[model samples]
Target: MANVDQDSNLDGATEGSSNANAPLKRNSDDPGWNCGTLCDPLNKDAIKCKLCGFICKAGITRLKYHVSGLKGNGVAICKNASKEDKAVCVALLENPKEDKIAKRKREEEMRAEVEIEVEDNEFYAGSKKKRRSNLRPLDKFTNPINPEGPFLNMRQQNLLDALSKERTHSVHQFCARWMYESGVPFHSIDNDAFEKFVEAVGQYGRGYCPPSQYLLREPLLKEEVERTKGLLKKQEEESACNGCSVMIDGWTDRKRRSIMNFCVNSKEGTTFHSSIECSTDSHTGQFIFDYVDKCIEDVGAQNVIQVVTDNAANNLAAAKLLIEKRPNMFWTSCAAYTIDLMLEAIGKEGKFKEWIAKAKNLTIFIYAHHWTLALMRKFTKCKDIVRPGVTRFATTFLTLQSLMEKQEKLKTYVY
Candidate 1:
């Protein structure tokens, strides 16, 4: 219930002097987090977990993981951390429904205060009250400004039906609650104490409070549907100016799934359209063509002037097929990918290949050894070696370019 300074390195935890070696005090809400037996001999700038006896660098995040029973980054989770603390920590790691309901309740209270207030009439004028006739039609009260604003959309209706709620669900309130509960100010979610704060009010609040995930599922779905509808509507409006071109990009996810994403580019601006999990079938020329055809049809065949994809055999086949079918709308490979391929090919030639290998080795050497990596950062003004891009060839080209730029500074450090 108490506020703590957010500026200190330890967020809600108690801040000590600026001495880098000093361990931050366990945050007020964090129960039973301390170093204990079997702690290895180490300098002051290291953390020793009391429950699991794991030692690591002195950082608040590591301490939090230990106290919250989160095992990550080579640190073992504390076995002795309270199950209550662990439960709250896990709930906030994902979206929780009770938090959303609480947030909506808070917004409603605030909005009630801000809106036009009506007070009871103090006195009536000294005049005889006229008898009222029931001749006025209540239908005349219908709003002329936004006649359809009061009704829910088909998506919202479907959402309510899925949830099996007795009546129609609210629209505006659902969206506000979704964002608030989802933690729109993203950095706050990283706080170890955020879950504690939410649970405190949720458990102690007056009246019946719904603390179930089922309550949130409907609202989250409705919000997502509305969000997609708004984006597509915006795209439709923008594309009216000059239509749009589609670009298809493919990548293999960690699970070995082939994913294809299609984006629209126009004078108005580039916008993402959709993605498809294409791992199911053989993505031959025919497979890629079928997906591209669907996108063209969705965006309007005549409106799409061009389709861009990589220069793979299957993609080339797809382009040929598209050209044969719709001659007016062109399909071609991406120019940037072509140039990146060239840079990669050039780097692989005879002596240049050796130079690229040495550059990679130097990067690996510094990164593998923490002390050297630190020294390298200090020398190069805190910039890491230019990271490799998604493609292997392109990655080599970029890292080589980066090393060349820092050649003089690296040489001085080496000597």
Candidate 2:
């Protein structure tokens, strides 16, 4: 502590203290600081305002303004002080000491709060600092903690810390699988509302940490494998020696990847057999024949009765090749494909094309605006227009039929 004599000088106050933890010497020039009364001088760094006999904490710089006749800093103006100091103080009532120390302290606290908010956001979005917590297996965490402890037996935070990398990764996989299967956008995790939800869980229900998409893929895949195996086992047990029919179809998905899907029907059940991505291979008769042959062999050719495929020329040729190899089973074209093709041929006639064109225009316009669609649904008691099916032939007739059914509602909505 620097000794302060009656003379007003701050030369000694600035010396002998380069350490940050050292008590700050009062700057005499500060609007709130000055000498105390002679009887109890220094006042252990308290501000002794003789005018109002007010004494406050040492660094309450605001008090200096009050003693100087200022009315800010949550203090009233003192009745005493020279007329000159009073004049200067009155103009500064709205603005008290803009002290660097107090400003810096407030700034630091604000920054800390901002940092906590950032961390919370990152956690909910399944993005976090790479720092490892010494978390143990959740098997241990399942046990209740000692109620007598200050907090829960194992602090939720300790549990968070205890999580091993593997367990954390599994949790991440769980979250990812949930979103992917539900068709949620991958970036939804980064939304502010999502962050608030995770933060709420942490604050109220116990801390929750979300997992990432990549983390979820592995576990969900394993689960899918097990689930498929279970289904296959059940089907095998239920199936009798009765003949089974296999149906196969080839198409490109929205992603433009070629896929071949197979299904089997029997006394057991109609079950999806498998799907193969054949993007790289040509969809020729030979390719289709080989796959059909493999399917028959795998399901036991002795129990196979027939095979079905769409009426594509390639599919028809492939079926012929398949039957030649295994004369035990017959190949058939799908009735649904035949119906769709017949409808398409009818729609292609010039007389029908006029009506189809008009229907297509109306559907295109109605679907373009969500509000218009909603209005149409309301008038029709909330039934949406039939969505276009995969095949143009089917889609056209289906939509036309729907338009015909809702003709009155469509007229009402149009006007």
Candidate 3:
């Protein structure tokens, strides 16, 4: 029954195709025919073209293009009227000369009014001398702390020293524990400042000294965090060549809270490694815009080229605002994100799911036997994921390439 219905639909489509080739018949709706009161002077019998004997079509755009004067004839008539024909041999009668002049005046007035309306709203109101809270100059940052001694004392230092000696321990992990033991706030302190201090004193080719004793004194961390932020803001302003792109993404904290994280990135240079602009607050479109604005103000906007991100609406909106502000700024969508979106769309559409399920079942089938697992690994080369531009992913091509290579193996694990 379904096959019969499909065949019937196909037959109807074929009939429509045959009818499409039939020659067009002239009617009142034809383009070349003057349906209005104005008539072509040469037309009398069926209002036909006298030269080519072709009937005038309805809904002609303008008769002026069809009107032309011959050497002796008052006006030659259109014999070869067609949609594409350039030469018009027929003169369609026009309205009185005064009516044409009045229409021209009305069109001019309408155009003038539109221009005035555009000019009225183009300028926005703002204070020229205003200090935008977002754009704090470097001199505005005020140091709020006076230092004295090692942040931690001898006993806490001993524990940190012991933790540092352990192969698997990181100083950040050790510092967090030390902060907990010393009764000083570690999580509340500025992480970047603490991180720098720890690196400089404990691990920078200088043998492990209980440097937290000197560095982690009395919750100077908050001040350090502020100071570090201020320095970063200053460096971005001072060095216009910092060639970094900022990425912003949002997520919920463990407490089911919303947060935005801003990260700055760039390729490593001859003298310095690439830098990251980690924002102090949650990521938001406004935050991202302000960050880009500040970065542009610091380094000239022209120096920064492209911002790459996943196709999140907020990120897309931010890119638009950035482009409006800095017209030359280019935006590239993240390659991995683009490919994932394409594949996800395909999965939702029900094409890829069966294949994906098959891959999953293959994992179950192979893993049940140890020999099958070895054979599977030996027979299969890594899966090839599509690159960013392959569908929509253009930015971060390498990242997507790597992901695609492991796609078959990862698909089993990814769901």
Q: Candidate 1's residue-wise lDDT over 1-415, tens digit each?
A: 1334445436423322332344444323333233432133234336566555566565535555555666654666767767876675455443445877888686445433433222332111232443232222331122121213532211222121223233223433454466698777756654445444333322222121343576468876788789877867766776766778899999998999989998988776788878999788798998899999998888888678899998899999999999999999887779989988888789879899899888888888899999999999898779877676867788887888888877756866886
Model 2 TM-score is 0.46
lDDT of 3: 0.47
Could you tell me every candidate's TM-score relative to the true structure?
A: 0.48, 0.46, 0.31
Q: Which residue runs does candidate 1 get wrong by more than 4 Å?
A: 1-216, 378-382
Sorted by TM-score (best first), the order is 1, 2, 3
Taking every candidate in turn, the Cα RMSD to the unseen true structure, in Å, is 21.3, 30.6, 30.1
Q: 1-415, model 3: which lDDT tens digit per residue?
A: 9999999899877865764543222324444443222234334323333335444343233332333322343334443545333332232323334678886676445433432122212222222332222212231122111112232211112223342344223334655676788898756564444434443442222112342544566455667777766757644553356566655445555776665454555553211212344445646677667765775555455556676678887777888888887787777787777777766666555665565555446456766877766654553442323233433323233434444555544544433
Task: Find the candidate with the highest TM-score and give its number.
Answer: 1
Q: Clash number for model 1? A: 0
The best-first sequence of candidates by lDDT reads 2, 1, 3
lDDT of 2 by residue, 276-323 (tens): 999999899999898888887788777778899987888888978877
Clashes of 3: 21
